[model samples]
Target chain A: MINRIRHILLLYLRETSFVLLFWVLVLGVLFAHFLFTDLDFHQWLVRYITTTQYPVFSIWSSVMLGAGIWITCLLGWMFKVQYAHPRSSLLPHYRSSHLMVGWICYLLIVIGAIWVIHVGGSFYQDTSDKQFAFFVAAVFFSAFNLILGYISWPTFAVVLWGMLCLFSNYEYFILTQILGEFLTNVFVLILTSSALLLLTWRLFHLKEEHWEYPYLFSWTRTSQRQHDALLTTLLDMVEKRLPSHQKHKPLKILRWDVLRFSIYKTILFFSAIILPFYLLYIKALSEYFLSFYQSPFKYFLLCAYSVIVIFGFHLRSISLWGRELLFPMERKRFIKEKGMNLLIQIYLLWLFLFILIILLPYMLLMPEFLMTAKFWSEILLTACFPLAGFGALTSLRDLSPRQSAFAFLGIVTITIFQMMQIKNLDVPILLMESFAWLFIGVLLIKMSYHKWCQTEF
Target chain B: MKNDIIDVKNVTKCFGSKKVLDDLSFQVGQGSVFGLLGKNGSGKTTLIKSILGLVRPQHGNITTLGDDPWCFQESTKEKIGYVPQMDSLYPWLRIKEMVEYTASFYSRWNSNLVNELIEDWGLNPQDRIGTLSVGESQKVSIILSLGHEPELLVFDEPVASLDPFARRQFLKTLIEIITRRPCTIFFSTHITSDLERITDHVALLHQGKIMFCGELDELKTRGNLNLEEIFLEMTR
Candidate 1:
């Protein structure tokens, strides 16, 4: 029993260490830069703290609640690969207590870490926020996290998703005016209690899950002929942009398992990112063109900014581009093909997303913007720049999504914020900005081609 | 009252319209050592996967331990230990850790036996499964499968990567286990002698169809040739 617990603990710790390392390295640098070089950043953060509608206690508790929920989710997900196969349940005499205890240990560590982050960030905070009510809220949030952590991961995932939906789109659930106000105030509590009840049932009544769904999303293993055609079409498009000599024999498509798994693997990230937009769009429709911050068009521009950041960050999925050793194609040609593939994929994705967004509640929310040239321009610039830039920049060097995502978002946020201050963006400014982004995007892509040519896979 | 531990009936599996297992039906009796043999891409692995519920056959029913292999219950799964042709051990885990983790799943785990086997196999407990040679990785996988002392052990080309000495030792182990515990073993292999030495019943899978499923001795007597020659003739 001790041995099993020890093993589980060790595994959890190892995973936790990797997670911590990424955060420390990224956040440490971010803090150092803002603390030292960027006085304006400090000013902005202070302003953000002061201008928020919520009081300090509410603010800190809300932050902790979000972190607590996220941490529980992370812990629950850490074992997914290890426990994916149903065979993991075949152990006959093993009790669920070990798993329960392991989850408790994870919860404690996470709560501690959250507290540390709270304390560290509140270096210049007032002491009034540390009242009994604040403590109660913190306790409640931590306790809720424990319940979430101990539940079956699929249950946790579903509940978490539902909670996010409820929190984001609760207005839809507000059946009556009297109940709606009450629901808004204690929705977190309601969700926590509901999850706890479900988890209690799961732990005792429904222990030994029999129903295991196959992957929700999977890549179809297409025919070799189909694969070949895909490659040929990709090559043909790329070849048009390349020198005549670059038009060579079709290299054997090294079958990437990623071709089958990438979307499913990244689905969690996709969902988490898209959920807010889903809610915001609903709110926009509800308020007749206004979201919390701006008009739906402007809010979508912000999302477009986000889309560019995501494209830049994820441009360097090494698996997507790392096939230099597998094929005999020259580096330039390989990079060109890869770049075109990425641009095409991103363009298709963004096009689909943009169309869907406009077709939905946003259709009624910003009905006039769809017909406007300004909106079209916004859509084009959003799709074109990132698609072009990432297509090129990623070719130059393999980049990590998490690390690069942060840096790219920071740059995009700062630039967008500055640009937003300019109340009027005339046609010339819009054209100039759009053209410049395209120029820079294309130039980087061209440079990346040369850079990749000389480098190893 | 069918006495068979495994029963496959008209199992037709297709991959992109190409039939991998076409109307495949067979039975292996309780405590019998069954050898599944076929040439590469002849659907040996696919058949095994179908039986294990890793892959679903479009038109067939498979029962192992008298329960449906497709969505088999934990109780049923506990009775069977399976090793695939290729090493499927978690790459990130050390051999020892993997053993311990795998043991946690089984109703019955013979820790002493697992330890003895790992030591006998000369596999380092601390070595990550990924760092080991293919042969060494296979040994770890074999140990994990046997740790629970399953009533039925299935191996797909179990000793394909092992050296001659290890192969001989493994065969010896199999024989000893079968005699002592009266367990059923269903394994696939390219090795003819290994089949000839241990398998009481041999089935030749060809072009997704069973060409022969009968007593090994009867097959040899009927063919008037060694298992190797019989295999070649059937496959050809």
Candidate 2:
């Protein structure tokens, strides 16, 4: 039985090695940040916890822990495991008894690693008293809910998650305060244990039929409606997220009404204006701004912000132009038409940003807190071209997702650096930057046209 | 020009180091029901895709309906109907919606024929495509391809998933449609018995090359072997 459990655990770990490695990398970064820099994630977390009341530490910590548990458990559940009846094995009760063992092994490693880092230290004891006991109970429920979620209705897990977060947030809850914290946990433990006993019975009572529930731990649609619903959600997401225009449109190469690309452009264009005001609503955002405002990372943050805008602008264009090349008819005409559409979308997006920047002072009703006309001109010229230019420069095959993202960052960084070196938002320097971007954008567009003409699917 | 509906000439398509179609050449004339027989990975699908202009061969010319297969115009596309080996139908839409969406693309769409066929197939138009079984989805794909009443129909393993009843009905439907109007039909299939029933011209594909290309009766008379035996012998 022990060897079977170990074998199952090893098999699962091997299958999900990439996901486990990604999680390990994230944890490694957090640990390294603590070790290398003065910034201790734990200490910072401790500070964040102390600031909020009602055992703010306990509730928030549980929410964080619950999210982690949910993520890991959800990843485990995504993989559908098959049950093989090993004739020689001692564990002969359930067809998927090994799966239960695998889940146990999974929870142990993930939760145990988190405990060693977060709760193992003296800092956890120093942070809050109520947190330690509250967290232990929260994690137990989270694990029980997510795994059992697949076997039963998935909504049961969602409800359990909601209950955990909701109950933890309330300071005046009668159950927690009157029943005492340890007693409340004891009640949940009994509740979970009873549920587990029911689950064990269900697991053991296996049938040769029920193709959907091939394994005891497997997730399957109870009805045709459930299957359709799952598939609809998946297909809708794939359709929406596929980087082409909404409709196939006319046989013409360059029509403008691609719904998907237009949606992002409209959102990004509006957000450039609306996001600043929305930031004002969140008091923490302004405080966050001030923190960066005083820090050395301020310039780096600004560059990142610009890169995000440029990246967002070109992201869909890569798909739009890439898809157009795959069409059976019209080579040159499609290129010319698609190029025009690309320019129009970029120009329109920039126009929205320009209008927002211009109207901001009047909307805020501030006279002294105003920018020069040079600033508006600078915004109009520089913002429109670089993103589209860089987008046109890269092909679907030439650069990977990581490469394009880094390239966008690189472009923004260089543009900012050049502007900073000049130390002026003067007309000539702005115009030079504008011309450079325009020239590059047009040149890249032409280069892409050539590549599109030649490349095959 | 030579009364050929499909003219694949000296087509050599390679994927990286391996050649999928090695100087493969074949033609299907108008009013001929041609069956392409091949083993798995014998480039039957690749050859079909190349003829449809979905795939472009590196070194050769393929002409479909007097137009370049690689750059098939709108008019040329209107005349061709294709059913792929695996139908990639969107699951979010209902059967009615899927039919309508496919119908919208073709200028020569036969809505009456499509509706009649859908009804005959016993498929509920209101049912979402995602709720369909594999055989049902294949039926939807066939209806989509046939709705245009295309002059040249191409199918890659069109009835691989159908049950015995559905397969009989499907083959009956194809025969009924073809009898109504003379059309060029080219399809690849593993079912040799079905091929013998439907096709007049049979082509055997082996190792990216055509080992046999002629009338089914001619091969049966000359070789004195059934299609399954012929296919096995050719592939082996």
Candidate 3:
């Protein structure tokens, strides 16, 4: 039984890359938490039990523990029936007896474990306190064992375990609080025994069906074949329907409409204008911002920077939507059209920011605020040029049809660096940046249009 | 009588240095069923795709209905119906919606014929295309191709997914339609038995060239050969 369990687990770990990555992330997070946080396991538990202010933390912890228990029990149930029953053309009476005996033995082991834990925990402490903790541990162990047994089961085991864990934990927490500790322990004991019997009977019924469960643990071979077949089928279908046509033009008109209809830009404008004021209000409430009237430039710079950053993020998201190819027109035309649409969007975004910056002097009742116009112009010019340049570069790359996370990250990094290197707010520098970007953008568009024209799919 | 509906002349196609379809040539006549027989990777599909204007030949020309096939004008497209080897119905749409959408692409769509086909095929209209079995999806695809009442119907491995009973039914349906309309039918299949029952003409494609293109009965009479034995012998 142990060998079988180990074999299945090894195959599962080998087959699923996500499962391997999940374990790596889990261990990494645990190591980081231990290194940085002053989280003594015992001390944390004591605080969790005593603190009234940390109800959310306590609830979350209880939920996790409860989930762990339910899953363990489900695993235990599945483990007891891991071996395949002999295939008999006719009904066999002896097979039923063997299965019944196995279930009885499994139940007895579980009861024995609970008894041992209960006695051991109470040997050092008072009898009443032992029940709640022991019951929780036993249920957790049973659920885990049942889950392990159902290795061949599809998503059902995982989903069932999750639901059971959530419900059992919530019930335990609420019942312990309202009915006192003793009643909660008694209630859990009754519930656990009933669930075990029901699950055992269900397992027996499932075993009666020969083809219900697959004998093999590893799906690696089958999954690869399925994937290859699906790809081949898709390629075959596409080849038959769409004869390799030269070039796909991006629709300029559609791109403009998408830009005009963008909700992200609106959100960015609001976040820029309102977030700084909200932060200032919070600082005032906390009595953190002393002499706000004297150091207004610092606040202005912070607000402007936040607004610029928000707009930059919004532009990045807008750039992503362009690759959807909403218009089935030629690829070159589509890219050119989308490029013009992006330019229009940038113009509208910059105009809105400029007007907001221009109106700041009147709102603040300070003529000196007009001095910051040079900085605002530099910020706008620096931000817009790079954004437009990146958009053009993306259109040039036209990495549509296939995109990776790394490509998106690279685009973001370029946009941020461009925004960072702005020293002057003079008209010449702004115009020069705009013209340079415009030339680069046009070059990218032309290059992309050419590439798109040549492409066959 | 010059009974040909499709004519090819010194057709050659290459991908880089590797020639996929060499100086291949064949003629498929009107009101006749032409069977394209080949082993895997024998350029039968490439030839079909070329005729559909999906692939351009490097040299020579193909004329379907006496017009350059590669031009693929709407007028040419309207007279032809194509059933690809794999079902290409959009997965998100219901079966009925897919039928309607596909029918809308053709100017001369026969709704009455489509309705009769849906009933005969025993397809549930409300079910989504994604939920269908492979055989069911193929039936829907066949119905879509036949709905337009095209002058030339092209099917690539149409009954590959179907069970024996469904396969027989599908062949029967095809025979019925062709009998009534006398449209040229060109289909590619590995199942020679199915072809033997209906096909009047056969083209054996091997290694990017046609080994044989003639009347099925004439070829059999000359050598007393069945398609399967002939295909194996030629391919081997």
Candidate 4:
């Protein structure tokens, strides 16, 4: 039994090695900071726990939430592969054993998290008081719900949970005074957690046979293929609904590019509609929270979102490169057309961002506050970094790991600079920085175009 | 020969330290069904891709239809049709939609031929490609390739996933196309029976080089055995 449990643990670790490596790198950086600076591990924990200020509280909480969600999704993926397969039919008893092992593994993770909190609290007992305890309990319960929800119905869980998150009043809910009197009691936490666990076990026992989960973990090799199958099915459905506009589009490549662009634009339209509502909801939560929103963190998120969308578009292009190139068009013409199409997409996205994030909010809710030049400059600055990234689409194949790291570092430095400039609000300096980025962006785009023209495939 | 549809001159290709194709050369005369036979991982797809200009060889040169395949012009591309070993048709698009998308690239598109193939193959124009079975998808791929009615057709293990009935139907279609027009066909496959039925000329690839390049009848006479036996013996 011990050997089997050990083997399962090893398998889980191997499967989640990428996420684990990310955590390791983050912890390593923290450790290095502690080594060089005056503040120790205990000091940092105290600061994190006690500092309920704007950026620190928001950044730490968001990072922790993101990490928890990522881990839950990965666990959901593993559970599907392990308990929900044809092989489980042959070895029925294995299901019970697997369930037992899975419970033990999960308990081990929870215990590990508790141990860290306990160690951190040992240095300063006040840090582990009611608020911190409630935070820990919330993390555990939410993780359980997320993983189970994801395992049961992926698209439903993702979309519904994502929508629910938009309406959440973080400041209103996380008031230490309000939460301290509520379900922050240790006894209540234990009872509720046990009940949820029991319910999960019963559900698993009853529907083990009929459990069908979508493969959402596209980073993993096996799951990537399954996810692709699911994507194709969804794409097929979407393709039927979209009009081809084939009459005006005489060129074949143009029609193809236009179809892809339409799909992308449609998604952006939905997001644009959702964004203003979400921002309004957040605004109503608290004026303090609104100030938190204006921080460099929002721009960082913008940059990240742009990178993700562009990366997805690039993946589609590269995957179809072979098939598309077989057509009669010159390689240069093909790439040039695709690049131009992508540029239109980027501009449309930027326009939507400007309208939804800037213009709409100012016109409707907070007219005078959002009209500041600093806010406008920050938005423009956000566009510059991602636009630079867009240029590297053609040169992505040639980008070495070192160059990528340097580029990431450069973005991080710019974000830090933007954070500092938030208080100062110097228009000349901001515009100068933006133009520098724009110049670099244009240069990279030209270089990539030249490189792509010379490339054989 | 100057009139040859595809001419290869000592093509060599390598990936890192491993050589996939080594000093290979062959020529296919116009209006001939040339079959390429090789064992699994014997660089059959690589060689086909090289001929199509999808892949570059480390050494030597290849000319298709009197132009270098590496820089094939639009005019040259218009004359070529290819069915890859793996069907890469967009699963998002329907048979009719995919056909339309592909047809737009060429000046001459035979919509009648596409519609006929779709109907004969028992595929609906409205059916999503993702919902289709492997054999059904392969049929769609074949239909898409043949829609433009190119002068030269290059197929890489095109019948691998096809059912026996579909395979026979495909061969019949191929025969019909050739009989209707003067065309050159180059195909690679492991199935010797299919090759024996259609191909006039044959090339045996072994260890990244052509072991035999001559008439199928001549090879059969020399070996005093069937095509399959000859293939198995040569490859073994």
Candidate 5:
């Protein structure tokens, strides 16, 4: 049994070396921060338990929790791959015992991390400080396990949200309030830990997970063919609503726009639905954001801009051009019309995003603050660069989508840096930047047009 | 004897250092069931793709339907159908929807023929293409190609994914289409029995070269062996 366990451990290490490396990096940074900082680490721990806001601690804990989630997902995927297969499910490889062992392995790692933190701090800390550290670690670990359980069994998340709604004030359920109970009495800690362990055990023993196999197959496998399937599904959903089967022949150019715009439209729809709820969540946790900024609207602008720009880079997929190559169309007309179609989609997306940016300030209850002429100029100047840069990159036949994405990111970073270097928001500077962007965009577009005309499949 | 539907002359296609097709030459006669036999990586797919203008040969000339395939006119395209080896169908569309979408591209589409084939093949038109099995998706792809009723049909290993029963049914449909119209079929497959059943002429491609290009009966009579035996002897 010991040798078997070791073999499985080694197998997991070999398969999931990247996740393990990330875990080690997180712990290493935390230790370095704790050891190298001038502040007393023990006092920081005490303050973290007592205070509501500790930005540095919060960031570290979030990183730690994120690493925990990453490790959990990787381990779960390893087990799921074998069990998801039809014939492999009948084999002896993935058993309930193996699942429990995997979870226990994860649990031991978290416990070891807490132990190291405690041992490293014992030079100047006392027993009370020890208990505080233990309670905080318990809360973090419990949150991690609960989240995993909630994901494994989605009904639990619904019940959890319902329970949260029943409370009159969210203050009653904040992390410090939960920790206060843990620090004041030992019984609460024991009961909560037992309940978390019981939940984890139940989650690990779930046998009827065949329903999730299809989703797992697509999510875990990132092949070009699967990517094409995803694009096809998105495009078909949009195409179905259009009058595809009208009496007269459908406009091929309009159909082409539908294909190009499907991804952006779906993303924009989801963003519209989620952004409001996200703002409300930020409102509920206003104390956290209040320390960094007076209003969440600025963050919203940043997020919205980043989302639109990030999606712009993803619009041109590698395998997508292959789908249209076999169609019987004049090559020159196809190229010229494709350029027109792309420009139209880019303009439409720009219009929709501008309206979204305008509406977001109103939604966050800061309508007047962001309506200045300078803000408008800034938005206009920056908005088209991402789409233009990415669209021009799409026309280049040599770069793969991944390489193009990296290039887009590099260009975006340089442009942002240049904009940031400008101290004054003068009209002349804004106009110059906008015109420069236009010149570069048009130049790249022209170059790509010629390249595309000469390209063979 | 018959006017050639597809003509290839000294086609040489190279992928970097590897030569996939070397100075290949062959002619597919009009209204004939032509079968191309080759081993794995023997450039059968490359040759078919060249004929359909999906691939450009480095040094050669290919003409299909009396026009350069590289720059086939819209009218020429309307009269040609191609079924690629892998079915790259829109998984989100239903079989009926896929047929309609493909039909929109061609000027001439036979809806009655499409419906008849779908029904005869025991396929549900409402079923989503993604959820269908590999053989079912292949059937839909075959149906999509046949819907336009093209004068020339180019198939690259069309029966690779189909089961034996579906393959037999597909060959039967091919025979029916041949009897029903003056259509030309050019296909490549590994299944010798299926080829022997349907093909009138055969071409053996080995090491990017054609070893035989003639009537199946002539080759069989010369070798005094079955089609599979002849293929092994020639390729070996």
Candidate 6:
């Protein structure tokens, strides 16, 4: 059983890098927290017992428990594979009994680790004035052990045990305030041991019984053909869009349009208009604004400006002209056609934003906050340049729907930085916005020309 | 005399360490119905995919209509029509919309023939492809494949999901189409009876290799037994 378990573990290690990476990340987090954080480790445990925020705690606990269940399930899966298809090449064949013994050994190591962490945390807490370093170490080790144990057990059992432990600790703290810490530690140990015993019994029953292995590994030939066909179609699509013989300039233009029009519309809308409005709403609801700011309307206007600038960038990005490849046209013709389409989309979006801005003063009941005609002209100029730059950036990135999530994050981060930088400028906000817009426009035109020159299709 | 439409030579494919198709070689002549017979895991589909240029083989060459299937040039692609084992039509598209959309891809699309097939298959032009039953979907797939008036047709397990009556009707339609056009029809199926009725040439594949490839009557005469018995004997 020990040998079998070792073989299974060895096979698992060979098969998956996810488990190794998971452990590495977990250990790294623990090490960092212990070395850097000023958090009181023992007090943190007490807080877990007393906390009433069940929703947050329950989610965290379930995540920990789910990891443990997956690990146990993986072991069962490996064992079944070995039993069904024994490797003749594996030297010094191990008995199933040896595997059972190995499982028990693994369980003991896990239980022992958990017991040590719990005992160490409790001991340090009882002896007040313990060094911060020692306390941190104890907490870190405890957290690591708890995580490992949770992953080692069945999913449901781990969840049940975690809930039981939390409630039992709470009850013990309430019933016996003086000896609560020690009693809780003892209870955790007892529960862990009992759960391990129950798991062992279950494993034994599973071993003795002739269980039907789920045929999860079987691949239907028809399904395989369909998958292959899809890949082939995708390859064909890609090849058609980016032909080998085409020059870089025209190909880039075509690629830009394709990326823009296909599945990027929703992303553009959210990043530009929707996201800015949400930020404005958040600012209005904030206590800082409510207490100090005289005009909530000004904040709304500012948000609207930010939205316009951000929307310009997104619009440019979405319209980078990649989609013209789908139609049967020469690279030069495709580039020209797509460029026209993009220009039209840009014009429409700008028109929509202009109309919205014009109506904002009346709808929002803050005519004074509205930009002056001169300010509007300056803002449009600044917005146009940056929007063009944003379009160029999007084309350069060749963004896909899968990468849109990360792109939105990048947009938000950039918007925050730009907004902060522009606020401190001595020049009028409108003028600054215009300059930014113009800069982006020049970049877009230059990039668009460069793309048309470089692309080969 | 050189009537071959598909000629695969020394074809090999592997997924990880397991070789799914090992040095496979075969040919399907023009104007003849070819049956590729294989068990559940045999490399029939892999061979079909390689022929269609869906999968690039690790080693060897496949020529379909005297051109690389992977090229998918307008002229090369126009010569062949394929009905995949599963329906590949966009489920959201209505029958008429799908036909029109597919028709756009081919220069030689026959709208009249497509309309005829739609009526023959009892398919409603306005119904979504997703709403169709398995047999109905197969009929739509067949209609789509035939709409382009290709010189060669490739179908993988065309009647695997069809009812007996539907299967018979599908075969009858297939036979009539092949007879009218004199196009090479390459179809893969597990059912030997279907092959026996319509197929002029047969290739029996077992464990990633062709057990036999010849005229169906020749194979029957050589073994002095029926095709089903011969298949079972060869596979075993």
Query: Candidate 1 lDDT, tens digit per residue, B1-236?
Result: 38889999999999767999999889989999999988888999888878877677889799888987755676787788888777556666788888887776565799998998888889889998778999999888888888889998999899999999899989988998899897999999988899999999999988998999999988989646888888898889
Question: What's the CA error at residue B80 for candidate 1, in Å?
Answer: 2.5
Candidate 6 lDDT tens digits, B1-236: 26789998998888768898988888898898999999998988888877876667889988888878654444666677778787545565678866765564456778898898788667899998878988898888888888878888888899998888778888998888887877889999999999999999999999888899989988989656888999999999
* Deviation of model 2 at A200, angstroms: 56
lDDT minimum window of 10 residues, candidate 1 chain A: A169-178
User: lDDT per residue, candidate 3, A1-457, as tens digits?
Assistant: 2332333333223333335344544664465456536877555444433332343343334444444444344434334333332111011122243345445545654675465344333332345544564555556456444544354333334333432332332333332233336666666667767776665565444432224333323224454355445434644554456544721222234233434332332334334666577444434332222222222122222222322333333444445544655556656655566555455445544544444433342234444645675555654454445444444444534344224234444544454344344433366776677677667766765666666556443
By TM-score, who's the top model here? 1
Could you give candidate 5's per-residue lDDT for residues A1-457 as a string of tens digits? 4443554454456443444456576676778466647767666543332332443343344334444445554555555443443212211222443555665766675675455345434432355644564555545554444444333322222222222222212221243333444344365556656765664554343322324433433322333345446655765666566774642212355454444433443454345676777567545655543443332222222322343343444355434656675668766666666666555555555555455434443445445646667666666666646545645565556766556656655664565455444336575777678677777777777778778777765
Candidate 5 or 1, higher DockQ: 1
Please tell me which predicted candidate would have the highest DockQ against the true structure: 1
Instruction: Output the TM-score of candidate 1.
Output: 0.62
Residue A402 C-alpha lDDT in model 1: 64
Q: Which run of 10 residues does model 5 chain A get worst, by summed lDDT?
A: A163-172
Candidate 5: segments with Cα more than 4 A from true spot: A1-83, A93-277, A290-317, A332-362, A395-397, A415-428, B1-236
Isolated chain B TM-score per model: 0.97, 0.97, 0.95, 0.98, 0.97, 0.96
Tens-digit per-residue lDDT, B4-98, candidate 2: 99998899988769999999788888899999988889999999878876567889899888888654665677687788787756565678877
lDDT digits (tens) for residues A1-457 of candidate 4: 4444454454455443334546754885476466547777556654553344555434453444445444555555566555443222212133455566666655655664455345434433344455465455554545564465434434333333332332222432433333354445555567657865764574344322122222322123454444445544555665556677522212333345444433343344346566766666545654554554444454554553445344444554665776878888888777787676566556655665566545665555567756688777777777786677676544665544445545555655555556655556577777777787788879888889978777665
Q: List the residue pairs that clash in candidate 1.
A: A91-B105, A91-B106, A92-B107
Clashes of 3: 37
Of models 2 and 5, which has the larger lDDT?
5
Please give the ranking of all candidate structures by lDDT, highest first, separated by commas: 4, 5, 1, 2, 3, 6
Q: After superposing candidate 2, which stretches have Cα over 4 Å from the reference?
A: A1-288, A291-457
Candidate 1 chain A TM is 0.56
Reference-based TM-score of each model:
0.62, 0.38, 0.37, 0.50, 0.43, 0.38
Q: What is the lDDT of residue B35 in candidate 1?
A: 97
Docking class of 6: incorrect
